[model samples]
Target chain A: MSESETTTRAIQVPILTRVEGEGALHVRLRGNEIEQVQLKIYEPPRFFEALLRGKPMDDVADITSRICGICPIAYQMTSVQALESIQGIAIDPEVARLRRLMYCGEWIESHVLHIHLLHAPDFFDCDSAIELAKRFPNEVKRGLKLKQIGNRLLEILGGRAIHPVNLAIGGYYRLPRHEELAALVADFEWGLQNSVDAAKWLKGLTFPEFEAPYEFVALSCPDRYAIETGEIASSGHTSIAVEDYEKFFYEVHVPHSTALQARKKPHDSTYFVGPLARIQLNYHTLTPIAKQTAEAIGIAPPCRNPHKSILARAVETVFAFEEGLAILKSLTMPSRSRVPYEVRAGEGVSATEAPRGLIFHRYRVDGQGKVEFAKIVPPTSQNQAQIEADLRQLLPQLIACDDAKIALDCERLIRTYDPCISCSTHFLNLHIERV
Target chain B: MSRVIRRVVIGIGSAHGQDAIGWRIVECLGRLGIDDVACEFARTPLEILDRCEGIDSLHLVDACIGPESGRLHQLQWPDERIVALRWTSTHGIDVPGALQLATELGMLPTSVTIWVMECEGNLIEGAWSSAWTQRIETAANRIARTKARAVRGEIFYRCDRTSGL
Candidate 1:
C-alpha cells in the first residue's frame, strides 16, 4: 500500500437514472489518496421561472406544485404565501395552522419514505424496502402504514396524493369538517408509536462518528419549532428574516451542471439544513411528545452529529403529525375557506419548510395579478453544495469500506438530504463513485 | 368473467414523418377513461409495446404518418405489416428489440391489437390533425368492443383471464 507502488484509480458514479429526477457523484483516487469528489447533478432545464411569467397569481400554487410531487405542499405554500405577500395580506393564523397540517403530512410521508424505504435499507444491507419486508415484515408494514397515513391525511385535506390540486392562493377552496380532523387524530394515536419506534430503530444502526462544524440554518420561533415559517438562524449565530434569503444566501452556476448550487453570503461558506440542524437549534421548542422521544434517545440539546439525522427526521415526523392533529382539533368549519385578494403589483418573498428544508419563492407581480417574474429556490438545490462538502469530508472513510458497502452508504447519505434533483435542474440521476 | 379490462391506450407520433398519427387517437381516448385500463400518454413505440406486456389483450391506437391522414387501419398482430414497423421508447429502445427481449424473458402480452391512424402531420407540434377525429367515437367504440369481446372469450375464445378496454 506504499504511495509509490499504489496505483491511481478512478471511479465515476454517474447520475443514477430513472428515479424522480437526476444527479451523480464523481470521485477520483490515486492509491489511497482520495483526489476528487463532485456531486454531479445533470437534470435538463425546465424553464419554471420562465413558465411562471404571465400566469395568474391564482394559478401559481397549482402550477408550481408540479415542480416536485414529493414536496408539492412546499411549492404550493411558498407560491400562495408569495401571492399573499404581493397583496400585503398576512393570512389568518387559522389558515397558517391548516397549512401546517398539510405540511406535517408531507414531513411524515417524506421522512418515512427516506428514513425507512430509501435510506434504511442501506444501513441494514438490503436492496430496497421490497427486500426489507422479508426479514422485517412487521417493521416494513409499520413503515408502509405510517407512509399511507401521511398520504391519507394529505388526500383528506388537499384531495390528491402526488399533487394536491385543492390548495389555492389564499387558502383551501374548502376547509375540513370536524369529523375528518377527529378521524385523523384517532389514526395518529398509532402513528406516534411508529415514529418513536422508527427513531429508536435508526438509533441502533451503526453510524460513522464524524462531526464537521457546519452553519446549521433553519427557521426558529420563540414559541414553537417553526415548520412552515419563522425567523431563520444558523449555528454560526447569524439570523435573518425570510425576506433576506437572497441577501444571506447566494446561488452559483457551474459548467458541469444545470443546478445553481447555493452558498452562504459574505462568508461564501457551506451550511446545513433539515433535521439535525432544526432539532439541534430548536430542541427546546419541540412538542412534549417529541421532546420526550428526544429525551428517551438521549439526544440532548445541540445535537451535532449528522449520522443520527434519521432519528431527528423521525422525531420531526411525530411532531408534524401531533401538530397537524392539534390544528385539526381546534379547527371548526369556517364560513369561507379563502379570503380573496386583488393584486397590487409588488415584489414578494415567501419561504416555507418543505419536507427536506426551507423552500423559497420570490415573485414580482403585475397589476393584473399576473406574475412578471418568479424565482423558486427549492431545498434540493440548496443541499447540493452541502452534499458535496460532506462527501469530501466523508470520502476517505467511505472509500476505506468495501466498494458495494460504500456505494449503498453513499446513496443513503444522499437520501438524507432528500435531494429533489428536479427542483435543481430546471433535475437528477443518483450515482455514486468509490475510488 | 369478472376482472376488469386495463385499457392501455398509447399515443405515438413523430411529427416530421408519419409522426402525427399517435397524438390524434390519444386525444380521442383520453376522455374515454376506459375502466380497468392503464391508459398512458406516450410517444415512443417502445413505451406502448413494453408496457403492454402481461395483458390478455392490448388495443393500441396510434397514427401512421405520411399519406394516410384519415384512413383507420386495424392491425391484428401475427400480421406482417404490424410486425414490420419498429417500436422504440423515448429512451432509445426499439419495439423489435423490446419484443426480442420480451421473447427471451417470456413476457409478451397474451394478445395485442393495434390500430393505426394513417396521418401526414410530420410528427411535429401543432399536429392535432387527426382525420379520424370525426370518426373517433365510432372508431374507439369499435376497437373497445372488439378487444372487449376477444378479452372475455366472447364466442370462439377461451382466455383464463378476460381482459381489455
Candidate 2:
C-alpha cells in the first residue's frame, strides 16, 4: 500500500447488469490513490430530437413516450405540458388532478420496482431480484403486488399501462367513471400501509456510512411535493422558472458517453436529482403520513447519503398512494375532457418531477402545429457527473479492499442513483487500473 | 358452464432497429383480420405477463441476437429439450425469465410458444432492414395461419414440421 510500490490492476465488468440501458464503469488508481472514475454510457443514441422535427406537435407525447418504457408517463407528462404551454391552453382543474393521479401511479410503480427488484439485491448481496426473492419471499411478493396496483391505476386512467394512447395535447381522450375511481380507493388504502411497512423494513437494512457534498435539485410546487409540474429548485438557490431551464442549465457532450451530461451554468458544477433530492428540497410539502414516516425513519433535511435513497423512495411511494387516494375522493368530472386550441408559432418548455428526478422537455412548433424542434433532458444524464464524483469520493476509502469487493462497492454506489440508463441511453462495465 | 378458450398473440420488441420485427409481425397479423386471436405489441417482455391471464394459448414474437441473423427460432414450452430458458433484457426481466416466474406463480397459460428472429443490426430507432422485412412476412404469415386453424378447433403446430432448429 506504499506510494513507492507500483501496483497496477484493471477490472472490466463488460456490462453492468440489473440496471436499465447499456453502461460501464472505469476506475484508474495510481499506487492505491484514485486517479479517475468514469461511468461510461454507450447505449446507441436514438436521435429522438431529430426524429421529432416535421412531425405534428400532437404526436410529440406518443413519440417521446416510447423513449423509456419504465417511465413513459414522465415523457408524456413533460411533452404535453410543453405543447400546452405553446398554445396557452389552460387545462381544466379536474384534468390536472387526473394528471397528478396518473403521475402518482407512475411513482408508485417505478419506485417499488427499483427498491425491491433492483436496489435491494445489492444490499442483500444477491445477483438479482430472483435471488433476493429466494430469501425474502413474502417481502418480494408484497412489493410486486404493490407494483401491480400502480399498473392497474395507470391502466384505468391512461388507457393502457405502457405507452398509453389516451394522453393528448390538452387532456385525456376520455375521463374515468366515478365508480372506477372509487374502486381504486380501497386498493390505495391498502397500498398506503404497504408502502409505510416497506419503508420501515428498509430502515432495518445496513447502509454504507457515506455522505458527499453535492447540490440537490428537484421541481418545487407551492402546495405539495412536486411531481406533475413545478419550478426548478436547487439547494441554496432561488426558484427558477421552468422556461429558464436552458438558461440556467446546459448539456455538454462528453467523450465517454453518448448521452450529454448536464451542468448548471456560471459555476458549471455537477448536481444530483431524483427521490433524495426531492425529499430534501420539498420535505415540508409531503403528505402528513409521508412526512411522519420519514421522521420516524430518521430521515432529516439535507440528507447527503445517497445510500439512503432507497428509504427516500419508500417514503415517496407512501406519498404517491396517499395523494392518489385524496385526489380520487375529491375528483369531479370536467365539463369537457379536453379544451380546444389553435396552433401558434411559439417556444415552450416544461419540467416535471419524474419518478427518478426532474425531466425537462422543450419544443418549438409552427403555426400549423408541426414541431420544428424538440429537446429532452432525462434525469440520468444530469446525474451522470454526480455518479462519477461520488465514486471518486468512495474509491479511496475502499482502495485497500480486494478487487472484487471494490467492484461490488462501485456497482452498489451506481445503483444508489437507481439510474434508468435506457432513458438516458446509459452504467456496468467496471475498470480499475492501479499503477 | 364451459369456459371459452381465449387465445392471444403478443409481439415483443422496441421501436428501434431490428427490434421492431415483433411489432412488424403484429401489424401484419392485424391486417390479416383474424377475429378469434387478439394481437398486441409490447415494448418489453415484462409486459407479456399481464396479457397472458385467461389465455388458453399464447404466442410471443421477438428479435434475438444470435449467430444466424434473419433465421427464426420457435420454442414451445413444456419441451424437455430446453433447460432453464433465461432471457436477458436491459429494461426488465427477459421473456424466459418472466415465463418461469409466471409459471411459478401459476399465471402461465397451458400452452405457450415464443418465436424469435435473429437480429444482428444495431437496435437504434429507424427503418427495418431488408432482411428483417422478409423475416417479418414469413413469421406473420405462419402466425396468422396457425391462428386460423386454432379458430377452426384444429390442433396444429406449424413450426414443428419446418423448424430448422
Candidate 3:
C-alpha cells in the first residue's frame, strides 16, 4: 500500500474493568502491520519499598504484606525469610513445615479464585463470574467452597486470611495446637478430591493453540514442589541464587507504563513466571496425587500454551490441598513459636514461590535492626514485558479480526497471567490506533 | 414455634482510618450488646460470602465515595443504587459483584442489607475524625434498632441516605 493509502485506526479501552488494579492498553497499527502494543500500567507507584526504609526489620513482613491482598502470605513469607536470613536465625523444622502449610493455603486460595472466578469465564465467553456461575453453578460453587477451605486454613494458622498477622521474622508469633490443624483434615480431604475434579473440568476448556518459546522461570526445591523456599531456576537459563537475581534480571522504565518491566541480562530477554513456569521447572517434585492428577488431565511438562495456565493453576491447587492435608494429619505444636535472634547489621535476600510466581525480597538492616534498604520484585513486574510479548505474538492471530475482537483476545491472553497489577504497580484500558 | 432467624452483620474494611467505619460500627454494635446477632469483620467480599452460608439475614457495612462525607446509606439487596456504590477491592469481586454471584449460586440471604458510609477522601485509606466517630456510633445505634425491629417482625421500610437514621 502507498503512504497515502495507509489509514490509521486507533482502538482504546478507557479502563480495564476486569482484573486487579488500574491499567490501560494501547495498540497502534499502520495499514496491515502492527506497530506497537503497550500494556500501560497507570496505577501510581505505591512507594512500598521507600516507606520501608528506617523501619525496624521486625516490621518488614507486616508492611510488605500490604502490597497485595490476594497474595499477602507470599509477601509476608518472602519478607520474613529475608529478614531472618539477615539475622542468621535458624527456624525449627516444625516451624518450616507450618510455613509450607501456610503457603499451601495461599496457593489454593489465590489459584482457585483465578481459575473459577477470573479466568474460567474467558473460556466460556462469559463477561463475569456471575455469568459463569449461571452456566456452571456446580463448578463455581465447588471452587468457592475450596477457596473457603483455603481461607479457613489461613484463619486457623495465620490468625486471619487477608494479611495474616501470625508471621514473625524468624517464625510465628503464636502457633496453633495440633487439634486446630487436625480440624482441617476433613476439609482438605474434600478439597483434594474436589480440586482433582476441578482440574479435570478445567482441562475440558478449549485453549487457544498459541505457544511462545518462553523462558519458564521458577524456584526449584530438591524434595518437594517449591513454595515457601527454593533456588531460582529457569528453563532457558542457568539457575541463580536469590541474591544474584538483580545481577541476572533487571527492570527498565518504559514511557507508557508506570510499572518497571523486567528483562533478563545479556539480551534483555523476557521470561514467564507463575504456575506454568513452576509446573514446567518443578513437575517432578509435585505430590504423588498432584502429579497423577496433572498427567491424568493431560497437563504434562513442556506445556507451552499460556492459555493452559488455567490448567497449571488447577493442578497446583490440587497439590496445595494434598500438601495441606498431609501437614494437617501430621500436625504437632512446635516447641517454640519463634526462634530468638540477636540484632546485627547485614544484607539478606530470599526468594519464594507465590501463587502467581516467584517473589524476591532483599533487605539491608542496621545494627539496631532497622531496615536501611529494601527491594521487592513481585512476579507481575517480572512478567509484564513477557505479557506484552505474548500479546505481540497473539496480535497477528487476531489482526484480521475487528479491533474489538483484537482487544478482547489480548485481554484474554493477559488475564492468563492473573497479573496482580496492584502488586506490580496494576488494569488494562485498551486503545488501538491503526494507521 | 416460629423459627428464630439467624442474622449476621459483616463489616468490610481494612480496619484503618475512615475505612474502619465498617469494622468500627460492627464493633460499636458489639459494645451495644445487640442480642442474638452475629458480628463479623472482613477485608474482601469473598470473606463476607464465606460467613453467609448458614445465616438467614445478612448486613454488609463498608466505606464508599458518595456526594457527602460521613453520610450513612442503608440500601437493601436488589436495589440498583447498591450496585453502583464504589467499594475498593484490590483483587477479586466487589460488593455488588459478590452479591450477584451469591444470588446466581442460590446462596445470597433472602434478607440482604448493605450499609455504606460515605468517605471524603481516598477510598483505600482514611482516618476517623471525631465527627466520623459520632456518625459511626449513630449508624451503629440505628442499625441495632433496625435489627431489633426485624427480630420483632415489625414492618421495616427501605431507607435511603436522606431518610432518618
Give model 1 RMSD, 1 decimal: 7.7
Tell me the lDDT of candidate 3.
0.86
* Chain B TM-score (each prediction, in order): 0.67, 0.79, 0.87
Top model number, lDDT: 3
Measure candidate 2: CA RMSD: 4.3
Give the least accurate 10-residue stretch of model 2 chain B, judged by summed lDDT.
B156-165
Best by TM-score: 3
Per-residue lDDT tens digits for candidate 3, residues A274-360, read: 999999999999999999988988787988999989989999999999998998888777899999989999999899999889888
For DockQ, candidate 1 versus 2, the one ahead is 2
Q: Which pairs in model 2 have colliding backbones?
A: A8-A434, A11-A432, A16-A428, A23-A427, A23-A428, A24-A429, A25-A429
Global fold similarity of model 3 (TM-score) = 0.96
How good is the docking of model 2, by CAPRI class? acceptable
Assess candidate 1 and give its TM-score to the true structure.
0.74
lDDT of 2 by residue, A391-435 (tens): 989988898898888988888888899888784332367888877
lDDT of 2 at A289: 98
lDDT digits (tens) for residues B74-135 of candidate 1: 66544555456644232222344334434434445656566765545444455444444575
Deviating ranges (above 4 Å) for candidate 1: A1-6, A13-20, A176-182, A298-300, A398-406, A423-435, B1-165
lDDT of each: 0.69, 0.83, 0.86
